[model samples]
Each structure stands twice: as C-alpha cells, then as structure tokens.
Target: MKQARISTGTQDLPMRWWSDAKTPGAMIGGIVSNAFAAIGSNRQRSILTMLGIGIGVAAFIAIVTLSQGATDSFTSKLGFLAQTITVSRARNATNTSLTLSDRDVKILSQLQHVVAVSPTISDEAEVVFGKKHWSTTLSGVSFSYLQMQNVSIGSGAWWSSEEEQSRRHVVVLGTKVVENIFGQTGIDPIGQTVRIGAQLYHVIGVIEPDSLLGNDGIYVPYTAVYTPSKPNQIAQISIQVDGTDNLDTVQTEIQMRLGQLHHIATDGSGGFDVTEAIGQLKQTQQQLGMLSGFMSSIAVISLIVGGIGIMNIMLVSVTERTREIGLRSALGAPPSAIAVQFLLEALALSIISGGLGLGLGLLMGYGLSSLLNVSFIVNTSSFLIAFGVSTAIGVGFGLYPALRASRLDPIIALRSF
Candidate 1:
C-alpha cells in the first residue's frame, strides 16, 4: 500500500495570522512597529497632515500660558493698589469750598488699620528749563506721597518735611518732564532750576521710569500749589491700609468719618466719593478672565478643525491601503487587528504632533512674555490637557475610518486598482 498522505484542508488547520505561542507583548510590539512603519512610508503626507493638529495645540497652549503669566505679573506688580483707597471730591458736588484738608488727613491717619495718608493738590503750569518749555500737570504733595504711591526716587532725595512746612519752591520731576526738558541737552536735571510761570523752583529729584503716580507730572509741596489764603485745602487724599483684609472695613470707616467731618448725610449726599482700589482690581481681573475664555473658545474651534483634518486623512489612508488590507485579511488577519493597526497609526501621528506643538507653544509663550515685559511661566495642566486632547482627537476621528477599512470585503477590496 502507498504511504498515507495527510490532507491539508481549511477544516484541518486553524486560519490564525498570529502564532498561538506568541505573547501578548509580542503582538503589541508588532502592531506598534507596523503602525510606525506605515507612517514612515509617507513622510511628507504625514507631516502636512499633522500641521492642523500642531497649530491647534500650539495656539491653545500659548494663549493659556501667556494669559496666566500676564495676570500673575499684573497682580504682583499692581497688587499694592488693592491695599489702597482714593478719596476725591465728587464732580457733582455743588460746594466748591468743601475741600480735603489737613484735618481730614489727621482723621484718616487715626482710623483703624490706616497706614498712611497723603493729600494731593493738582494744577497745570508751563515749566521752562533754559530755552526748553513744556506745559505739564503739577501735583502738590507731601514727602509721604512717594511712599504711599509706591514711588521710588530714581536720582535724588525727596524734600524734607521742613521744606514742605516752609513751603519751599523745590520740585521733583517725573520721567516725562526730564525727557522733554533735559533730553536734548543731555543735562543732569538734579539741582537744576526750572521756572514755573514767573517763579523759579529747584529740582531735588527725578522720578523713576514707570512710576505709577509720577510719569507725567511734577511734584512739589502742597503748600506751594495751594493758595496761601486757603491754608490746608487739598484736591484729593490717598489712603493706604495695612493689608488687603482691612480694605473694606477701612473704606467704610473713611466714608462714615468724612461724612461726619463735612456735616453731610452718610448716604449719597456727601461731597466726596470713596473708591476702593480692590474693586477696580477685581473688575480688571474679571475682564481678563472673560478675554481668556473667548480666546480659549477660539482655540477649541481650532482643535475641532484639526480633528476633522485627522478624520479626512485617515479616510484617505484607508482608501489608499485597500489592496493591502484585503491581502492581510486573506492571509487570516482578523478585522479587529486591521482596526487596531489603523487606530494606532492615527494615535502615533497625534502623539508626535502634540509633542512638536508643545515645544512650539512654549517658545511662543516665552516670546510673548518677553514682548509684554512679564514673567514667563509654564503650566503643567496645559501640557497634560494638550496631550490628552490630542490623543482623544486621534482615537475619536480615526475610529470610523478604521472600522470601514476592517469591514471591507476582501474580494471587493482586492478588485480595486
């Protein structure tokens, strides 16, 4: 008898593309390698397709980080404003004689939690230094004014209390005044004599650049600006509190005390208005928050557009690999494997793109901070959110195309050119 031959039929052998002895790790390694290989095969198309996601991620990260940096800078730099209060005569006040005075200053100083008080008298005059004459505002204040406004003397010392009491004609020039009067001559402004109207005043100091209260005016003793006829009348009073915690209480006490001093009702009939700096700060922060939200919404729209781009490219990829998919199916690859391969390819693209975008965003945010003269800050949440969103977009947008590819009939797919 002839030797018995073993039949190799479909029913006799299992049609498994992967080996039964292969570990799950090996399967995962193979899938990942194949995904990278497919992406590498078309480098130019992959990079171009990645642009949409890259741009979206970059804009999102940059905007958020930059906004946060700016807000922090603002709060730190101007935070002192929150611990201060401003008292000004209301514009609607009919009594021109109801002016702030030394009495008001004394009362404000003695109030609970009050740290400092400085009265200001504002006027305008033509300042003449040699042939240079520039018209500017004049602020008449005491030595305590500089400390209260967080202003530092850039060049020379502030006038002494005796100089203020004697009503001496000494002036502290702001940066703008120096630029205009002494800029062309390159002259040292300190100890220089400048004429205000018909009177001459010595410049004792120069205000530092970017001073909150001294950028565009000249400062002198309040007694120098106020009429000798009206001894202690002042234009406004600036009050500093010990800390933020006492701001509301101090403001209320100030209003009540001033109302009593002026012999006016405490309601709305008072001649003066009290403005809490913290309120203005909160309003500004709210505006910034709103602006950040609007920009974030735009960034989200960009991400959605990028997701759509991902889906479009994935559908194109599936179509291009029709014959390959059919061949793999015919070779006993399961539909699940086909889906996983495509999905992995999409995920890989997004991961790479997100990384590139994150780097670009950091650079952009740093440049922005430098441009705005603020601090550069990196937020960890931004990185995590960016990467997480990118991965989600890949999976979400790539799923349909992957399923469609897996469902393609091998006979029909193979017929495609």
Candidate 2:
C-alpha cells in the first residue's frame, strides 16, 4: 500500500488515474483490463494452454456420459420389473449351482407376498413349418410364465391349465418367429403344427411386443421341449411380488427359504442368487459413478498440466514486462494491483478454457448419448465441476507467479532493460 503512493511530484498515466479514484473499484477494474490486454497479446500460448484443459474436460465428460448410458440401457427395459425377483445359479469364480426343484417353486409361490413364480428353461431346436426350416430358441416354463412376465398374447392364448396338466405338446411363437416363418402376410399361426426337433408341437399363441415387458421369448411346456442335461441343473425362477412395499422382506424370505431347503450353511454366501431389478439398477448406478470418477480423474490431470503451463507463462510475462512493471510501480500502482493483475490473467485464461472444454464436453456427451441410445444429461453439476476446477487451478497455480510479479524491485526491474 505504501509503495503504491504517488511521489507527490509526478503525474503519470496510472498515478493520475489512481489519485482521483474514490473507491477500490477503479483499481480492480484497471487490473482486470490489464489482465485481458496481456492475455490477448499472447494469443497462441494462451490458446495452447487452453487446449490442454479443454481436451481433458471433453474426454472426462465423454467417458462418464457413455458409461452412464450403458448402465441406463441395462436398466431401462427392466426398470418397471423392479417388483420382481429372480433366483438363479450363482455366477462367481467358485461356480456355485442352484438346484431349484418343484418344491422350491411351490414354496416361493406359497409365500404371502408372492404373486406368481415362473420357472424358465431354455434349449435350441430346429423348427420346420411346411419346409420353412429355421433354428430358434425354445423357452420352457410353467403356465404362469406370461402372467408373471406381464407379456401379452398377440393371437390365440397361453395354453389352458388342462393342456399343461396333460403334458400336451403346446408352444408359443414370438412375433418375430411369426413374421419370419409365415412371411408376415398376417397369417394366423394358431392351431398350426410346427416340428420342433423330432416332434411336432401345436402353436397355441404368439407373443406380442410390449415395450414395458420387453420381448417375450418363444415359449413351450417344460415337459414338451426342454429337458435338463445335467442331473440337477434346474433353470431360473422368476418371482413376482404381490406389492412393492415388502419387496425387501420378500427377497429376504426367499433367500432364507432357499438356503434352508438347499441345506446350505447360513454362515456363507447362498448357493442361489436372488436378483432384483432395483437392486441391480442401484448397483449399476454406483459402479458407473465410481467408474466415472476414476476415469474423469485421469482426464482431469491434464487440467493440472494446463495450470502449470499458465504459471510458467505468467512468470515469463513478468520477466518480459519487467520495465513496464517498474514504471507502473514508480507511478504508484499498488503491489496488490500487480498481484491481482497477474492472478486475473490466469483466471481469465482458465475461464475461457473451461468454457471451451464445457462446450466440447457437451458435444461429446451428446454424441455418446446418441450413439448409445440413452438420455443426454448436461446439468448444473457439469458446469460447476468444470468452472470450479478452472477457478481452483487459477488460484493454485497463479499464486506464486503473482507474488513474484508484485514483489519485483522497481529499480532492479527498471535496470533490467
């Protein structure tokens, strides 16, 4: 403050400007103006530094957006199915198996909160409909499969309980199968005999497409087409809850019941795995968040590098403008003004780069969302993260250089030229 005082004998550009100023606003305004002037004078160097940060931020947004979209894709179709829980063989390094039997399905169905339980089995078989031979996946399930899955029948109907009880050779065709085999001429496939493997089965219904339930699979009777190759290789069980309020309780009950039925020790992981859509969705969200943070950190490292570049450039600016700095100090420009001027220059550079990075990142994120077929979200968090990082980088990297600029000895600086 003392150093900024006019010598009381000289009137110059900065001295005259400050001598009449009633408030600190004028000084602050001058500092900002000078900072902009300096940045504009070194366009190439500033642009290159900005490029470093912009590239990093863009990559960060791209990675997060793409990964988040992938997770969204995983949960989108099954999101409404959150009320349903599935029991399947444990997928792990130990390769644990679940031996689900009729008794287990019965137990699940009899639970107070359980609505319906559908046991599913899958097998690949060759189908022939009047010499139009095609190989298709055959899914075997209980009579309640369509009801539990919430899938609709397009034509005819799910087999009657009498048909299922008598082990009748009834099958259901997916709409795609109907189109492919029947040439999509609106031919009715009901009551037609389709040869599956060595036997011909009656197609009793066709599955209609419902976005809510996703694509219903080609279905057949458990006794008709699919047989377990391994002795106890029972397929998955889909359990629909009567309501969502007690979903957790229902899941816990199922786990406990299955554990007791399998005679597995309660101290370890269950031999069977129960999968809930909401639970998986939450897990996927957490995993994506972690992955986004980890990957974004790697990309944000470039901003640190850009900050170093700004500091180096500011130090060089001070060195190159030593005479200007000395003249300004001699004319009563405060050391605080010099420091703030340099800091402002760094801040300006960062803000410009940060904005550029933000725009590029949005563009990249939009492209990723389109490519991955998910929602594009550019909310306040993105702006805050970017600008916050920029401001921090400016303050952190510009401090030492600003101090050096402010502390320069006027006489020595004047003599440097």
Candidate 3:
C-alpha cells in the first residue's frame, strides 16, 4: 500500500525539532548537541576567529583599569594641593637679587580667604649621627608646618610652639633620614642627637614615610637656620585657602601684594612667583583622560573587526553545511530548527571567546598595573558590559547568515555541489 506524502511547508515546521524527542527539554538538548558538533568540525578556524575578540577585550580592560588606577593614585598623592598655593622667587625675574621674607607670610595671612601660612627655608647640609653621616635637605619651618603639610608623626610628637619660638635646636627627621642614620640597629630615634651643618640638634619626632612634603628631608625651627646677616630670608611661603573657589583670588592678591612690597611692577616684573597646584593637577588628569579615551576607541575598532570576522565565518559555515541542511529539511526538520542550529553555533563561538577574553584581559591588566606601579582594580560593571557586548555581537552578526541558511530551498540545496 502507498502512504500519503508529508508536506514540507512552513506551517508544518514547528511540529518537531532536529530529533525525535518527546519533551521540550530533550528537543533543546538535541539541537544544542548538533550545534556544537558543527562548531567542533572546524577547530582551527574557531580558535582563530576567537583570537580577535580576545585581543580586543584584553586591550580594553587593561587601558581602562590602568587609567582608573593612575587617576586614583594622583588624586591621593596630590589632592591636598587643591586648596593650597605656593609663593617662591620667580626664576624668570629680571632682578635675580629678589628674595622672599617673613613679611610675605604676614601679608598673605591677612588676605580675605587665607586660612593658614607657613614659610620654608630649605638648604642642603651634612647630617652626622654617631658613626654615620649623610648629606640631605634641611628644611626650616614654623611650628604649624607639620599640620599644614598634612604630615603625620610616626613615633614621637612634633616640637612645641614654644620650642620653635625660642629657636631651640630640636628637629623632626624624615623616614629616609632615620633609615640612613639609624640603619637596622633598633635604636629609638627620639631624643637622639644629630648634627646639621655644625649645629647639634636633638630629634623630637620622625615623619611618616608617606608624607608628601617631608619624604626625604629634616625639619627644624626656621629661626635656628637663619643667618645673622639674613635673618628674614626665606625660600618659599605655602598658603592654605578656606576653599577651592578662592584659590585664584588669593593667588592674584598675593602676586599684587608681593609686587607692591618689592617695589616692582605687577606685569611679570615682580620678584616672586605664585603657582596654583590645583591647576597643574587638573591639566595632568585631563591629558590622561584623553589618552585613555583614544586607547578605548582603538579597542572598540578591534571588537568591530572581530564581529565582522564572526559574520564571515558563519556565512562560510552555512555554505559548507548546505547538503546537511537540505537532508535535515527533507527528513522533517523545520526552517526554525536549521536557523536555531546556526544561531547556536555563533553564540557558542562568541560565548567561549568572551570567557577566554575575560581571563586574558585580567592577566594583561595585572601585568600592566605591576609594570606601571599602579593598583589593579576589577570593575564589575565593566566586566558585565564586556560580556553583554560580546553576546550581542554574536546574535547581531550571525542573524543574516542563520536566516539565509534556514530559508534555503531543500531541493535546490540538495542539487548544489
């Protein structure tokens, strides 16, 4: 007896999938297995395609992580300068004889937005402690210098105001200075006597190693360092403003005041220079941000190239499996099943690529952070976005090829070479 012929129409396609499965889960499993089998057939091409994605991801992650780490480090190291200004002898002044003095400090302190003023007298001196001697910077500062500079005392207390006022021979040592003199002898630095130049000064405190201003110097009363002939001579004056908004105003006021005091014109003829640290910090950060953006743009181009490669490869795959697709369609597989199989292959390729890219990116970030001496940070949002973008690329790029494969006429496909 002759059986009735089955219709291979679009309406009849959804009745079953790639296999004779009785349940939805089992049907899905069979489709997935077939998709992976197709991918496994061309192992070399698959890996090469994924390489583009991996490189793009690694570059993106490393650049962003390094950018953030550098910004954080700079902010921490120089954040204090945002509210401070410094006055020094102008290096480009026509009159090189001009110098700073205590008068500048008092005048700056009386300004409207001024919060604090501390003067510094810096010089290099041979420091001798017991059998060891080292030449380091000797900074003469006021009693308020430590607090103004945000310096922390490591082991001993900062000198008293009275001690500074009386011109006592007491000093605060930097961590480097202590290390050079005391070595690893386990000696208590406080109360130890160290000679600076020819004067014997007792160590009253040790500055924390991370102190920005006093990292490699010694601090003493400004009066103790003063020569009898130049009693008011000072190197620079550091002024703290009440807020960041008033930094420019205070800086201008200081320049005008210094010009008037020195009997010089205010038009770049003044003997002093005024610098806003915040301006320098902003400029540096802006340059860094631009560089990071440029690098990220290149990474984005890499991703686009990788996506194109995926589309090209998937199209080639569809062509290579034309006979198989026709056979499946003739054996009762639907266009939806054929489409799903191709789509799944693309997704599997991309998902695997993304996973590999993630690991490679982290390693690259870590190595870069170490080489650059910055912190290594893993941002969760960035990670999620990377993964999501990869998945989307898979679906978007693979859609056309999948559809073309599904829509093929089984009779035509079967007759083709």
Candidate 4:
C-alpha cells in the first residue's frame, strides 16, 4: 500500500509543502496548536508530567518564601527589644559569677548620650492566686524600665517611685501571666493580691502582649522585692541613648565605665560586656538572612530536578514524533518550523506549570503562616525569578531535542516507520 501525503498547505505542486513560515505569529500558533494536539492525544501522561512540575515548583516557592517571611518577622521582633544601648551582666567564662549593680546603672546613666537607665533583677518565682500556682520569671524594675524597654501597660499603671522607695508590695503582670492566672475573665487584676514566693504583692498593672524579647514575666517595684542585705545589686542594666545616631558612642562609653568599675581589663575578653540594641538587631537580621539563603539553596535543588524532568520529557516527545517530523520535512516544511514547533510545546508546558506552581506555592505559604501565627509575605522578586528561570530551563533543555527533530533525514525517518 502507498502512503498518503499530508500537506499543511493547499496548493498542489511537484514538491509537497508542510507549511509556509512567512509570519512568525502563524508559525508560533501552529507550534502551540500542534503541542496542544499532542498533549490531547496523550491526556494521562501529559497531566501526570505537568502535575510533577507543578508540585516541585509549589514546594520550592512555599518553603523559600515562608522561610524568608519567618526571618523578617524575627528581625522585626528583635527591633522591639533594644534600639540603642543595652548593658547586661556578663557571665565569667572561667567562673559562674554574673552580676550588674544599681551603682553600675548610675554610672552608665552619667555617660554621654545616655538618656535613661533602668536596673532589672530577674528571678524565676512561683505566683499563687487562690489554689492555682504558676511559675513565672519575676523582674524587679523601676517605672523607667517600661519606657527604656519600650513596653506599655495594657491595664492599670506601672509602680511609682514612692512605691519603689518605700518597698511597697506592688506588681505588674505580663500578658501570659494574666492569661494563666485570670483565664480571659476580662476582670481587673489590679488591687488583687498575688503571692510571689513567700511575699504577698498587689497586682498594680498588666503589660500588653508583646512577643519581642520573649520576656513574658511579672514586673514589681525594684525595692519591693529587694533583699535588704544586697540593696544595690541588680541582674542587668538597660540604658537608652538620647538619639539613634548616638547609639555607638553611648555603648562604647558605657562599656568603658562598666569595665573600670568592675576593675577588669578593657580587652575584648572582660568581666563585663555591653551590647548596642541596634547591633544585636542587625546581627539577628544577618543570621536570619543566612537561614533564608540556606532554605533557598534547598529549593533550588528541587527546581533543578523539575527542570531535568522537563528536559527528559521534551527529549521523549521529539523521539515519539520522529515520523511526523520526517513527513513534514518531506512535504517541504523548513527545519526552523520543525524546531519552533517542538520548542513552543516545551515553552507552553513550562509556562503552564510555572503559573500553577506559583499560585499553589503562595496559597500554601499563606495557609501555613496563618496556621502557625507567623507572617505571610509574598516576595515579588522571588516569584518573578522562579518563573523566569523555569521558562529558561524549558528553552535551554528543549533545544537539543527540538534540533534533533528538525535535522532528521526524511527518507531515513520514513523507512523506520
């Protein structure tokens, strides 16, 4: 039986022609049309392959974007802890001694650019309300501590200087403490008696819910919880700089004064250390950046796997359609037309997968963020980069396969099938 010729063009002549490649749009349209036709012929396989690419893209996008959002949220929280100068008791590497005193706070306050100084004494103590007992870290701090730490009272007011001076048994509770003791009653906790350790103290206020610094504790008048024998000793000292720009200078001066007071060498390894809050914030941001980068690297590996899948599928596509290519070439179709058709098919597959993956990724990221109570932030730059890279992968990997189909010998291909 003689084989029938399939001519893309209508005109009959000595040489049969597959198609006229005069218009670029027409050529692209034909390629797209043929690609869809091919996919339609192998519905199950096409769907499975596309799904694989989509899943890979979605996972990559969600993991990378979500991790970046977490890093940003952490960095933002660090900003709330300290903006300028912060002085805390340094642990002795050789020994277990760690102490910062009120005298040291006073000396730090006298330094240039130091606007305010607050001494804090923190100890884990049990609070008793009725029959309920909850263990919480109790902080002894002056009223200035609130302003210095950028914390606000959600209810009632902070302890007054008079209360601190007279050793009054007044306290302020953190949000977690209120939740544990009050259980969402919305009842005023102020004027209520809560026992801390063996001492009964009045709950004068409650702090607003703040995730920054993670110090969900109870605050009391600095003098109220003081041990009379150790009047001036405090666990740490926080110093706020007068201006953001003066933070570096203030931190240096405070460090020098603290080292001199402690009679320690001013070398980097000293008995005490002073940290600028802004410096700590930047360090935290850098660490988060590193984590994000690590996550992106993992995502890249998955994307590469997906790209390889695309290349393998395209190669198979060219092989399966060898007879079609030979027939088209025998009918006078140009090599460029054959190549463009295969390339366009690969491009379409990539675009479809990329779009679906991007949407799924963003949705998954948002869902996870909502579930975890973390922020969901879609990075536009990342989305664009992913799409662009996936498309490029399709073109780059599809090139050899497309060219193979384009360069096939018509007689040889026809004889094989």
- Local distance difference test, each candidate: 0.83, 0.75, 0.81, 0.72
The TM-scores of all predictions, comma-separated, are 0.89, 0.76, 0.79, 0.86
What is the C-alpha lDDT profile of model 4 across 93-153, one tens digit per residue?
A: 3424545665676677788777777777778999888876789888888777777666667
139-223, model 2: which lDDT tens digit per residue? 8788887776666777788886677767899988876677677764466789889888888899898887542333434677765
The top-ranked prediction according to lDDT is 1
Structure candidate 4, residue pairs in collision = none
TM-score rank, highest first?
1, 4, 3, 2
Q: Model 3: residues >4 Å from true position, as ranges?
A: 1-33, 40-48, 228-233, 266-269, 294-316, 328-340, 359-377, 395-412
- Best-to-worst lDDT order: 1, 3, 2, 4
Tens-digit lDDT track for model 3 on 157-202?
Answer: 8887798778899998888888988977689889999888879999
By TM-score, is 2 or 3 better?
A: 3
TM-score of 2: 0.76
Determine which window of 10 residues in candidate 1 has minimal summed lDDT: 5-14
Error in Å for residue 88 of model 4: 3.6
**Maximum-TM-score candidate:** 1
Full-model lDDT, candidate 3 = 0.81
Q: Poorest 10 consecutive residues of model 2 by lDDT?
A: 5-14
Give candidate 4 regions above 4 Å deviation. 1-22, 93-99, 184-187, 213-216, 231-233, 259-269
Predicted candidate 4, C-alpha RMSD: 4.6
